[model samples]
Target chain A: MAFVLELNGLTKHYGNIQALRQVSLEIPQGTVYGILGPNGSGKTTMLGLIMNILQPTGGSIRLFGEAPRADHRQKIGTLLETPNFYHYMNAVQNLQIAAAIKGVTNPDIDGVLEKVNLLQRKNSAFQTYSLGMKQRLAIASCLLGDPQVMVFDEPTNGLDPVGIAEIRDLIRRLAADGKTIIMASHLLDEVEKVCSHVAILKKGVLIAAGHVDEILAQDDLVEVSAANTPQLPELLKALPHCKQITAGDAGKWLLHFEQGTADLRSVNEYSFQQGIVLDHLLLKRRSLESKFIELTN
Target chain B: MNLNIPHLLRIEWMKVKNYKAFWILMILFVVSMIGINYIYWYVKQQFVASGDIAAQAAGSMIFGDFRFPAVFKTVSQMSSWLLYFPGFIVIFHTTNEFTFRTHRQNIIDGLMRKQFVVAKLAGAFLLALVCTLLILLTSLVFGLISGDGYFSLEGLQYIGFFFVQSCVYILFAFTLALLVRRAALAVGIFFIYGLIFDYLLAVWISRGTETTLGYYLMPLQVADELNPPLAELKKVIGSTNQWIALGISIAWLAFYCFFPIRKFEREDL
Candidate 1:
C-alpha cells in the first residue's frame, strides 16, 4: 500500500520524559488512520512532530515521499490541537489567510465553510463562536486548498454530542472523498465508528496497530439467551459445532467455536433441529473499547 | 530566488489592515502630531506678527518646551516622538504573533520560519517609515503655513533623520517584544523605557556635577548620536559618545531579534 506519511524510528523527549519511543507508523493513502491512546500517550506530540510544530529529538518524518517540503505542508492540513486562530477574524477571513499562506488562490473558503455547516457563521468572529462552531471552523480551515492529507489532534476535544456527530460525519465524508486522514483522539467509540485502521499508543509506546476489523477478530463465540438457561447449555454442549459451552449471567450461554467450529449455516440448522427456542441469538463481536482496554494494559 | 516576497508582504499587509488597534493608534499618532504642530504654528504666527521681543522669547520657549524644532536639520525632534508611539506600534506588530498563536499557524501554512521572521521585520520597518513620514510631512506643512520657512534642505535632512531614527527605534522595539514574548510586558517595558526611564535617569544624572551625564541617559543622546540627525551633536559631544550609543543600540537590537528567534525556533508550539 502507498503510504502518505511515514515515520522512521521517530522518538522525541521532553526533559527526562520520553514522548515518543521509536514509534514509527505508516499512514496509507486514502485511509482514515485513528491514533488511539490516553492523555500523555504521545498522540498530540506525534501530530506536532508531523506538522513540524515540534521537532523530534531523534528520528525523521516524510510527507508524501518528501522530507518536510513546503509542498508537503500544502498537502497536509493540520489541526494539531485545540484550534488556535485569530479570535477577531471571521471564518471567511481566517480561511482566506490560511489559503493565501498555502499559495492557493481564489479558494472556496465559503464552500468549505458551508461543508462544515459554518457558512452562516462565516462572518462571525472566532471569539464569538461556540465551541462546536470553533471546531467546525478549524476543520474548515484544514479543508482549504483541498489538501489530500488531514491531521487532527483531538478534533472533538470539546464538542457537544451533535458537534461530535457532525465531526464524525465530516471525517467519514473526507475519507469517502479519498482524502488520507490521520487523526489522534482518546475517543475510542468515535474512532471505532469511522476509522478503518488504528494505532494505540500507551506511554510513548505503540501497544497495538492494525486494521480495526482484523484487530478485533479474535475467538468467535455465539451468545444465546433463553428462559430455560440450563436446558440451553445442555443443548449447546451436544452440538457438533460447539467446541465448549459455558453458562453466563442473565440466562445467557456462551458457545465457543474452535477453528471455525460454527458457521451461520450450522448455527441455524442446529437451532432448528433441536427445536430449542432462543430469546436472543447474537454474534459475540469484540468491541473496540474492550480491545483498547486489553491493549493499553 | 523569487520566493514570493510580495505574497508574504500582502499577507502581512492584510494583518496590519485588519488590526483595528494598529489603525486607530496610527491615526491617533498622525492626528495628534499634526494637531500639536498646528498649535505650535498658530502660537508662532501670533508672536512673529506682534513684533514683541518678550512674546518672541515666549515663542522660543514654546519651541523649546514642545521641542518642535522650527527647522528640521535631522530627526532628533521626530526621533523623540518615534521613540513614543511608533516603537510601541512596532512592538505590537510582532508581539501579536505570540499572543494570538498566529505564528504557529503561519508555519503550518507552509511559510518557512525564516520567511515569517523576515516578513515581520519588513512589515515593522515599512510601518515605522510610513508613520514617521506622516509626522514629518504634517509638521513641515504646518511649519510652512505659519511662515516658519523651516521646510528647507535642512528640514529635509531632519525628516530623513526622523525616518532612519524611526526604523532604528522599531528595530529596538521589535527586538524587545520578540525577546519578552508577552504583549503586556513588552508594551509596558517599551513605554517605560521610551517615556519614563530616559527622562528620570537624564534628570537624575544631569543634576550631578557632570552635565554630560544626560547624554548617556537621554534616549535622544543615543538616538541622535547613532543616527546623527544634525551635524551639531558630533561637534558638541564628539564622535566617541555617539559611537558608544550606536554600539549600545546595536547590541539591544541583536538581543531582541536573535534571542527571541532562537528561543522560538526551539520552543514547542
Candidate 2:
C-alpha cells in the first residue's frame, strides 16, 4: 500500500518516563486516520514526533514514503496542540506568516478564512478572539497553501458545541474532497464520526489499529426475555447467525450476531414457533464508544 | 520558502510590525539612548560655560572629546548604559515565541529548527545593527554640535566596537531567553546579572588575582573598556588588554550565535 506517513518502531522518552513506546503505524494516502487515546496516552507525543515538534528517542519517520525533510513538511498542514498564532496579529496576518513559511506566494488568506468561517473577523487581533474563533483561525491557517496532507491535534479543543460540530463537519468535508487528514483526538465519537481508519493507544502502547469498521465492534446484539427464559436459549443457540449466548440482566438472554444479519422479527417468529412466548425483545447495535472502552481498558 | 536573510528579516518584520509593545520598547530605547548622550554633553557644556578654574583646565578634555573621532567614543560610551533597552526587546521578542508557543507552530509550518533559531538570532543581529546606527547618528550629532569643524574617522573603530558591544548585550539576552523561555524571568536575570553580578564577579576576580584576567573573564565585562565611561580607572584597575578582551568577546559572540541554534535544533520544541 502507498503510505502518506510511516512510523517505524517510534519511541519517545521524556527523561525516564516513556511518553511513547515502540509502536509503528502507516497511514495510507487519502484516508482520514485518527489517533485515538485518552489524555497522557501519547497521542500528542506521536503527532509531535511526526511533525518534528518532538524528537524521537528511537526509530524514524517517513513523510510521503520518503525521508522527512523540512520542506517535506510544507506539504502537510498542521495545527498541533493549540491555535498558536501571534496574539497581537490578526488572522490575516497570522495566515500570511504561515504562508510565508510554506513558501506560498500570493496566498488567498481570505479564501481559507472563508472556508473556516473566520473571514468575517479576519482583521481582528488573535488575542481578541474567543477560543472557538482561535481554533477556527488555526484551521484556516492549516488550509492555507492547500496542502494535500493535514494533521490536526485536538482540533476541536476549547470550542463550543456548535464550534465542535462545525469543525467536525469541516473535517468530514475535507476528507470527502480526497484530502488525507490525520487527526489526533481523545474523542471516541469524533473518530467514529469522521475517521475512515483509527489507531487506538493506551499509555504509549498501541492497543489496536485498522480500518474503523474492522477494528471496532461490528456485532448486532439481540436482547430477548421470555416468561420461560429457559426455553429462549435453546431457540437462540440454534439461530443461524447467532455467535454468542449469554444471560443478561432482568432474566434476559443476549445473543450476538454478525453485523446486519440479525433479523429481529425472524428471531421473534422462530421463538414463538418454538412455543416460547417472548415477554420483551430489543435489538442493540454495539456502540464504538463501548468498543473503544474495551480496547483502551 | 524565501528563507534568505532579507526574507527572514521580512518575516520577522511581519511578526513585530504591528506589535505596540515592540514599537514602544524600540522608541524607548532610541529616545533614552539619545537622551543620555544629550544630557552628558549638556552637563559638560554647562561646566565649560562656568569658566571656573577646574572647568577651564579640563576644557580640552571635555569640549575636545565631543569633536571628530573622540565624539564616536563619547557617544558610544554614553549609549552603552542603555543597552538593556534593546536587550529587553530581544528578550521579549524571543521569549514571546515560547510564551505563545509560536516556535512550535513555526516549526510545524515547515520552518526548520535551524531556521527558527536563525531567525531569532538574526533578529538580535538586526537589533544590534540598529542600535549601532543609533550610536552612529548620536555620534554625528554630538560631533556636529561640538562646532570644532574638525571631523575625521580617526577613532571610528570605537563605533565599530560599540556595534560588537550591542551584539553582545542583545545576544546575551537572546541566549538567556532561549534557555529560560520566559520573558519576565529572562529579562530579570539579564538585568540582574549584567548590572550586578557580571561586574561583581569581574571585580572579585580582579581583586583576588591582581591581574586583568578577571575583567576579561565575563562576557559583558570583556567589553567594559571598549566604550569606557571611566577612563582614569583603566590605570587604577590595570585594565584588560583590548586584543584579549576582543578575542574573548568574540568567543562569547560565537556562543550567543550558535548555542540557541544548537539547542533548538537538537532538542524537542
Candidate 3:
C-alpha cells in the first residue's frame, strides 16, 4: 500500500457498549503514526482490532494493500496493551516462541535483550520482572525478525522517566531507519514528540488526523516584542496571513496565524522591512496536551 | 488439520519445556499412576490368597483380577480414574495462557485462530497418548508378572478405549479452561461437574439399564460406562453394540476438537 496500514470504518461494540466506533485512517509507509487518545478512548481496542486480537463488529482493514491475514501480522511486529509472556519462561525462551511464529529462521535474541538492557537478567522468569522490565521485554519481543512495520500499544506505559525516554529514542531511531511504526498511546506529549502522523480518537471517534504539525497548527501562536515599539501591534495586524494580534503579559503581542503562515522569519523580515524590528520574536506552538483536550472536549 | 501441527506443537513444546510445574505434575502423575497400580496389585494378591483358598474347595477361584485379559481391563479401569490428574495439567496450561494474556499474544504472533486452537487440542491429544502409553506399559508389566496366560492381547482394546476417554477428559478440561478463563474456577467446576455431578446424574439416568441417555453424557460420565470395571457393568452402562459406544465417544471427540476452533475464531481474545 502507499500506506502501511489502512482502516475503513472499523467499528466494534461489546453488546450494548461501544468500545470503538467508525475509525478510518491510513498510516503511510515510513512514518511513525500515532493513535493518540485518553484512557478508554479506544486506542488499545483499535490496535487490538488491527492485530486480529479482537474481531471488528464492522469494517475492513488492509495490511500492505491486501486484506488482513495472520501472516500479515508476521511481517509486522505488534505489542498489544501489555507485555504478555509465559511467567515461567525466561527472556530467550519467550522470544524464541515469537520468532518461531514469525517464521524467523534465526532471531538475535541476545542482541535484543542487550538493546533493552535486560541482558543481565535474561534468565529470570517473566514473573520476576518489574513492570518496566516486563515492558522492555515486550519491546524486545517486537524487535524480533526486524520487521519493517511495528505496532505498539502504550510502549512506555509503566516506564520510569529515563526508561520512557530511552524507549522514545529507540522508536525514533527505528523510524529514522525507515521503518513504519504504528504506536497507540494515551500520552499526548509522547505522540507529539514522536509521531510524524497522528490520529486522535476521543470516546471511539476519530476526531483529528494528518501531519502532527497540521493537527497542532489549529491553534498556532506567535509572540512578538520590540524595544518599546509602539507600531508593533498595528504592524502585526497588518501582516499577511495573521489571524489576530492581541496583547499579552509582560509587554508582548500574541499573533495568531494558520499553520505554515506562522513562519517566524516572515514576522522578523516583515517587521524589519517595516523598520519595526528591535528586540524579540518567538514562536509559541501549542502542546499536544492542550490540542488533545481541545479536540477531545 | 492443515499440517502445520508439528511446528505448532514444537512451539508448544518450547513453552512447557522450561515450565517446572508442567514437568513436576507430569512426573507426579506417572509415578502415582504406576504406584497406584502396584498397590492395587498387592491388595489383589492378598485378597486372592485369603479368599480363594476357601472358595477353591467349593469349586471356584477369585484370583482372576490380574489374569491376561482381566489385567488389561483392570489397569485401564485404574488409569481412567486418574485421567483428571493429567487433566489438571491441561487446565493449568490453558488457563495460564488466559491468565497471562498470552492467548492474545499467540494470535498476534501470526498463528491463525484455527492453528492456535488446533495446536492446543493436539497438545491434549498428545497428553492423552502419553497417559495411554503409560497405561499400556503398566498393563504389560502387571499381566506378565501375574503369569496371566502367556501375555494375551485379548483385551488390549480397552487400552484404546482408555486413550479415547482420556482425550475426551483432557480436551473437556481444556474447553472448560478456555471458556472459564480462570484456574481455580475451572478446576472447581471440572471436579464438581465432571466427577460428582455428571457421575451421579448419569448413573441416576442410566439406572443400570443396558442402554440410555446417561451412557452418552460428556466429560467422564460418558466414558465411565465404556471403562469396564465389572464385565456385567459394561452391558448395563453401554449398549450391547460396540458401534454405539464408539459413536458417542467419537461425537464427543469431534465436538471438543472443532468447536473450540470456531469459538476462538469468533470470540474476542
Best by TM-score: 2
lDDT of 3 by residue, B154-247 (tens): 9988888888889888988998898999999999999778768886777677675533767575446667656745654445445534456667
List, residue by residue over B123-185, the lDDT tens digit for candidate 2.
888888988988898899889988568778898888889988888998899899999999999
**What TM-score would every model get versus the actual structure?**
0.82, 0.96, 0.89
For candidate 1 chain A, which ten residues in a row score worst on lDDT? Answer: A258-267
Number of clashes found in candidate 3: 0
Tens-digit lDDT track of model 2 for A88-205: 8999998899999888999999899988788889899999999989989989989988889999999999898888999999999999989999999988888888999999889999
Candidate 2, position A8, lDDT: 91
Deviation in Å, model 3, residue A29 alpha carbon? 1.1
Off by over 4 Å in 3: A218-240, A245-254, A258-285, B1-3, B51-64, B207-211, B232-242
By lDDT, the best candidate is: 2
Better of 1 and 3 by TM-score: 3
The TM-score obtained for chain B by all candidates, in the order given, is: 0.75, 0.94, 0.90
Candidate 1's C-alpha runs over 4 A off are A218-285, B1-3, B42-70, B73-79, B148-151, B198-221, B224-259
lDDT of 2: 0.87
True lDDT of residue B152, candidate 2: 86
